[model samples]
Target: MKKDDQTVTEATALHSFDAMLTTYERWAQPCSQTFSRAALDGAALPVGATILDVCAGMGALAVPAAELGHRGWAIDVSPGMIERAAERLKPHAGWSTEVMDALDLHFGDNEFDAAFSVLGVVYFGPETGTALEQMVRVVRPGGVISVVNWAEPLGATFFIPVSRAVDRFDDPEVGKFVAPLTEFLEGPQLERALSGAGCVDVRSESVSGHFAVPSAEIFMEELDSVFQVLPQYRAAIAKDRDRFRDILVEEVLLMASKELPPARANIAYGRVPTPQETVGSSGLATS
Candidate 1:
C-alpha cells in the first residue's frame, strides 16, 4: 500500500474491533482496570458522581463503576464492542453502552461529573490534541479526566511482538508509528495536552505489571485483534507471526524474572480548571 493509503488503512484497522474482542479483553483488562481505578483514586472523584467511560472496551471499567453506584455511559466506535459492553453490563443497572466515538463524543458541555479512559485516548494520530480537548470539553468544571495508556518502545517482553509486527509493515514510507509508538508522554506532553485542554491538578504515575501466562503462545495468541487492526501487519508473513510469537515468549520468560507487567505508560488525573482560572500562553490555565 502507498504511504497515505497505508496509514488510512491502519487507522481503519485501529478503529474496527469486532473480530478481536476475546483476545483484547483478556490481556487488556488486567492493566486497563488496575491503572484506571488507580488513576481515579489519585484524582479522588466522588463515588456517586456520574461518569463517562470513553473508548470503554467491553465495559471493563464501566461495570465496576456501575457496581460502585456511579451512573456510567460507555462509548466505543465498534458496534460489536457496544453489544459486548451491553451484554456485560446488562445484568447491572445505572450503566449503558453506545457505539459513539471518543473524538466526537455526543454529550453536551459539562454534561458529566467525571470522564475516565482505560487504554483509550492514545490513538488520535495527528489529531491527539483535539481529541483530548474534546474529552475535557464534556466534563463539568472541577470534574476529573483520567487516562491510562501503554508506554512505547515497549520493554523486551512486550516490545518483541510489537516490534516484529511493526516491522512487518509493507510500506516503508510511513515514518511515525501506526499508533502510540513513542508518544507515551510523561512530563511536558502530559502538561500540554491536559493543562492545555484547561485541566488542572494533573498528577501521574509510572506503574507497571507482569501478565502471567502458560506460555508465549498464549500471549501472542491474544494479540490477533490488534494485529487485524494493524493494516501493515494484516498482510504480514506467516514466518513473521512465528517470530512475533517466539519473541514474546522469550521476552515473557525474561520479564517474568522481574515480573510481566503489561508495561503501562501512565495514569493521569486532572480536573477542568474553573472558568475563573487563567489560560496561560502555553494553553495551560494558571489559577
Candidate 2:
C-alpha cells in the first residue's frame, strides 16, 4: 500500500476503534481475552520471550503474555486503544504500547522472539498480507508468528441476526454497512498468508467456544454501541434509528431463543526460518 493510503486506513481505523472504546471491554474483550489465551498457548513461547502485539486492541493479548513472563510492545492505530492498552499493561513492567500501524512496524527487524495479532489484522482487507509480512519481518528467525482469526460460517453466527435485521430495511446500502465486519479468513487461507510471508512449519487449528450474552436486550445494546462507530451503519439508519433498532432487537430476540451457536476461530502459528535452516533447505548448501 502507498504511504498515503496507509495513512487514510489508519485514520479510519482509529476513528472506528475510538468510538468503540467505551463498550469494548464489556462487549468484545471477553471473547478477545479467550482468543488471546488460546493464541499464547498455541505460540508456546519460552518464558521471558520478547513479544510484539500487532493491532493490540485494549491489550488483550499483551496482558496474558505479560502474565506468562513475556514482555514487549503492544501497538494499535488508535491513540485511545493504545492509551487503554497502556493502562492495562502498567501493572507489568518491560511492556510498552504505541499508536503504530501494523502494515508499517517501526521496530527493527528480528527485534522480537514472537509477534502476534488476535482478530486484528483480518480487517486490513487487501492489505492483510502486507500486515502479516510486517509481523514476520520483526520477529527473529526461528521465532514464532501467531494470529487468531474468526473461522467462516460458525465464525459469523453473531452477525447473522444483524444481517437479518438489515434485510428488513428497504435500502440496499444497509447490507454494505455490515459487510466489512463480517468478512473472515479460514484456516488454510491464514496458513497461506503466513507461509507467503516467509514463515515455516506453519500450522493452523480450529478453536471453539461460546459467546454468552445475558439477554437479547444486552445483545442489542452491545450491537448498538458497535454500530455507533460505523459511519455506514449511521448513514443507513439516518432515516429512523428507532425503527431499525426495533427490528434489530426483534431479530436478536428471535435468534437468542434458538440459542446462539458456538463461536469458532482459526489459530495459526509459524516460525521464521533461521539462516542456517534456510541455507539447509537450498540445494546450494553443503555438509
Candidate 3:
C-alpha cells in the first residue's frame, strides 16, 4: 500500500507494539474469550468451512479456528502483526498468514465460506461502501460475513473522546478517528452500509466488554500499548512528547475510573447477496 494510504506511522506503531504484543495478547485472552464467542454467535459459521480473518492481529481467532473445525487464511496489513500471527499460528494445521489490506483484499470471487473481523475494520477507509462490498464479495453467496467493532466509546480507549478532543479530523479513508459531525460512518450509517453492501438479514448487537479484567495492571498495559500512537493519536499533542503522555495518561485514568462500561459491539452478519443484487444497493460510506 502507498505510504499515504495506510495508517499513519505504522512502522513506529509496530515498533512501539513489538515489546507489548506478547503482553497484550496474554492480557487480551479475557476480552478475546468474550469477542470470539460473540463473533461466532453473530456469524454462525458452518463447521468444516473455509474462513478469512481480516486484520487478523496476532491470529487471535485464526489460531483458534484451526482447532475449532474451520480453516482460516489470516491476512494483516501490519508487518508486526503478521510476524506475531506467524509465530502464533505456526503449529496450526489449518491456518495461513499473509500481509494485506482490508480495503483491497486479494482473493478470487467467492473465495471462502465465511469471513470474520474481530474488533478490526475499525478503519474501513474513505470508501466504506466499497470496502464492505469487497469483504462481502469474498464470501460465498449463501455464506456469512461478520464485522466486529466498537459502536461507541464508553471506556478508557476509543476513537470517540480523542476525536472529540482533537480538532475533528476528516480523514475517513484511513483512521477510525473522524468528526462526530460526520453522518456517514456511525451507528445508523453502519446498518445502511451493510444493507447497501448487499448483506441480507444484516444486524448488530451488544457483545462482551462488561466483564472485569484480572487486574487494572493488565488494563494499564493495554492502554499504554495503544497510546504509543501518541504521534498519531494527537499530532499536535505529540509535539511535546512527555507533556502529551502526561495529558493523555491523566485523561485515560479518568476514563478508566469511570466504571469501564461493557464494551458495545455492532456484529453485522448476513448472507452475501448475489453479485447481481449487490450492484443495486443504494447507500454511501455506510461503515
Winning model by TM-score = 2
Q: What tens-digit string does per-residue lDDT give for candidate 1 at 4-71? A: 43332223533556777776576656666666666666666677878889888788778778777778
What's the distance in Å from true for residue 216, model 1?
4.1
Instruction: Note the Cα lDDT for every prediction shown.
Output: 0.66, 0.78, 0.61
Cα RMSD of all models vs. native, in order, equals 4.4, 3.8, 6.5
Clashes of each: 6, 0, 3
Give the Cα-based TM-score of candidate 1 against the true structure: 0.79
Best by lDDT: 2
Tens digits of per-residue lDDT, candidate 3, 1-287, equal 22345433324334654656765566554465467667775676767789898867787777777767788799877777788889878886777888877778899889999888765554544555666777888988878877765555422234333543333332332244433222232445566667777777666666656644333333334555654453345453434445444544555456667775665555666567654443344532122
Lowest lDDT 10-mer window, candidate 2?
278-287
User: What's model 2's lDDT at 138?
Assistant: 92
